[model samples]
Target chain A: MISMHLTYDAQKVYMKVLEECLKASSIEYELNGWSEVKLKGQPALSEIRTFKNKLREAGIYVIENSRHELIQRTKDTISEMILHQEDLKSPKLSTYLTEKLNYSYTYLSKIFSEHTHYSIEHFVILKKIDYAKKLLLESRLSLTQISYKLGYSSVGHLSKQFKKTTGMTPTAFYNIIQKRNRTL
Target chain B: MIRGFLKLAVVEDDKSSKKLFQKAINESTLVAGMIFFQQSNELLEYIDGPQNHVPDIIFLKLDPMVKNFLKDLRQVRKQHQLRNTLIVIYSSGASEQLIEDTFVYGANVYMDKPHTYEKFREVVEKILKINFQYLESNLNIENFIYRT
Candidate 1:
C-alpha cells in the first residue's frame, strides 16, 4: 500500500511536469491538468529543451521516477526553498532540509553530492545566484533589499557571492540589463 | 447557480494540495478570482494589510507547525471586521473537540480534504452551494459545521 501510494504520487508529479512544459510552449495541448495530456503533434527536441530550460530557470525541478526517489525529493526541496525566498531566512539550510526531508543533513548531503556531482551547498548557492539574477532584472528593488530578501547577512556578502558565481557583480549585471532594456 | 461572483482565498501549505484545489475551483465560473497562500503568516499579512479584494470565502488548511493559526484567524476576522466572510477549515483529520473549537473561534465550516480529484471538485461545489445558497436564502446561524 505504501509503495502504491508512492507510485501514485510519482505519477502525479510526472503529469504535472508534463503539463507545465506544455503550458510553457506556444503549441496548444488538451490537458485537464490530470490524466494523460493529448498533444496535437510531437514537440521538436529544441522546443522540448526550451521548455525544460524554462522550468529550470524558474527553479522548478522535475525529476524522472526511474532515478532515485531521494534525489528527486532533495532537488524538489532545494528548488522550493529557492523559489519561495521566504524560507531562505529561518532554521538554516541544513536544518531546514533535515526537518523537511526527514533525513540526516549529512546523509542528504552525501547522497545529493554523489548523484549530482556538486555539493549541496554549491547547489544552493547556484540557486540563490539564479534567484538574485531574476530579482535584478525583474524588480526595481534596491541591492540591499534584494540581498536581505535572499537572506544574505549583508549586501557585501551577497555581492561577493554573486560575483563569485556569475563572473560579474550584481550591479554590473543590473547595468547590462538596463542597457539592454533601453536598446529594446 | 451561485448567486453572484465570488472571491476566494485558500491557505494550504502543500503544493500538490493547493494545485488540486485550484484546478477544481478553476472548473467553475462562479468564482471571480482566487488567492493562494501557503502559510499562516502570509495569509495573516494579506488579510491584515491593505487589500481591496476581501474574499467572500476562505479555505484554510490546518498545519501543526502553526500552533496559533486558528486563534490568529479568528482574531483577524474580528479585528478586521470581516464578519460576513465565511471561513472554512480544511483538514484531513481532526478531533471533534478541535472541530468544535474551530467553530467557536469563528470558522463557518469544516471539511475534510478529499483525496480524489472528483471528490475535491464535489467538495468545492457542495460548500459553495450550501454556504451561498442556503445561508443567503435565510441567514441562519445554526447551519455551520459541515462534515463528510
Candidate 2:
C-alpha cells in the first residue's frame, strides 16, 4: 500500500466548477482571473439565464455591470502583457491594449483613468519597473541585459525610470544588497 | 549584519488568509522564518519584548473590521528597530483614499489581496526577491500599490 497526502485549493476548485458550468452552457469564454470571464459572443437571453443558473448552483455570480467588466478586462490584459513580455508583438502598449481589448486607446485610457484615478500609461510604467526590479534581484542579468529584456532603448533610459520609481539607481540597489549579504 | 535568510511577520485575523500565507511563505526559498499575529497589538507587543527577532518584512492585512489598522501601522513605523524593515499592507477592496493614506503613513507596498493560490504564491515570491532595505524609506506614491 502507498500513502500520500494531497491538499486542495479552494480557488482552484471554484475555477474547475466555473469551467464546467461554462462548458455545459456552451459558452465560448476566456478565464482571466477566478472571478473575471471574457465571453466570446453575446449569448441569447435563455442561454444566459441557463449559464447563470448553473454558476449560481456552484455558488458563483456573474458580474453584469459593464463598467466593472471593462475595468477588470483592461487590468487583466495589461497584466498578461507584462507577465509574457516575449509574447508581446504590438509596437506600443496603447496599440497592444487596443488590439487585445478591441477598444480605441483613447476610450480605454479614459475609462481606466475615470475608474482607477490613474492613467493606463502610469500603471504600465509601475508594472514594468516592478518587473525590472524582480529581474535584477532574482536573475544574473546585467544592466544592459535587463534593459533590453524590458524593451528599453538603452541602459540609461532604464536607469532613469528605475531611479524615478525606486529613488535609487540599479547599481546602488545592488550595492545595498551586496553590503547586506556581506554582513550576513 | 542580518542573517542570510529572510525573517517575515504577518498580522492577519482571517484564518483562511493566514493559512494561505503560511503555505505561500513555506513554498518560497527566500523566507527562513515567519511569525503570525492575529492582531496588530499582539505584533506590537512581540516587537517590544526583549530578545525577539526583528523581521525583515512585515505583512499587515488592512481590513476595516480590524480596529486601529492605521494606528498600528504608525506604531510600527515609529519603532527604530523596524526603520529598515519593509512594511507591506494588503486589502481585498481598498479605495484610492485608503491606499493613499497607507502610503502617507509609511507603508512601503500595498497589495490587492490575491484570490487564488497561484497569484498569492507569485506575489509572495516576487516580494521576497526584492531588496527593500534601501528602498523602504524612499517609496513614492506612484509605486506604492503593487497589484498582481
Best by lDDT: 2
The TM-score values for the models, in the order shown, are 0.42, 0.44
DockQ, prediction 1:
0.01
C-alpha DockQ of every model:
0.01, 0.06
RMSD after CA superposition, every candidate: 22.7, 16.5
As a whole number from 0 to 100, the lDDT of residue A79 in candidate 2 is 69
Position B26, candidate 1: lDDT: 74
Against the reference, the lDDT scores of all candidates come to 0.67, 0.72
Q: Which tens-of-lDDT digit does each residue in A113-174 have in candidate 1?
A: 54454577876776677677777767888889888888788999999988765445676555
Clashes of each: 0, 0
* Model 2 interface DockQ: 0.06
Stretches > 4 Å off in candidate 1? A1-184, B1-3, B141-143
Over B19-73, each residue of candidate 2 has an lDDT whose tens digit, in order, gives 9999998776556679999887788789889976688889988886656767778
The alpha-carbon lDDT assigned to residue B40 of candidate 1 equals 54
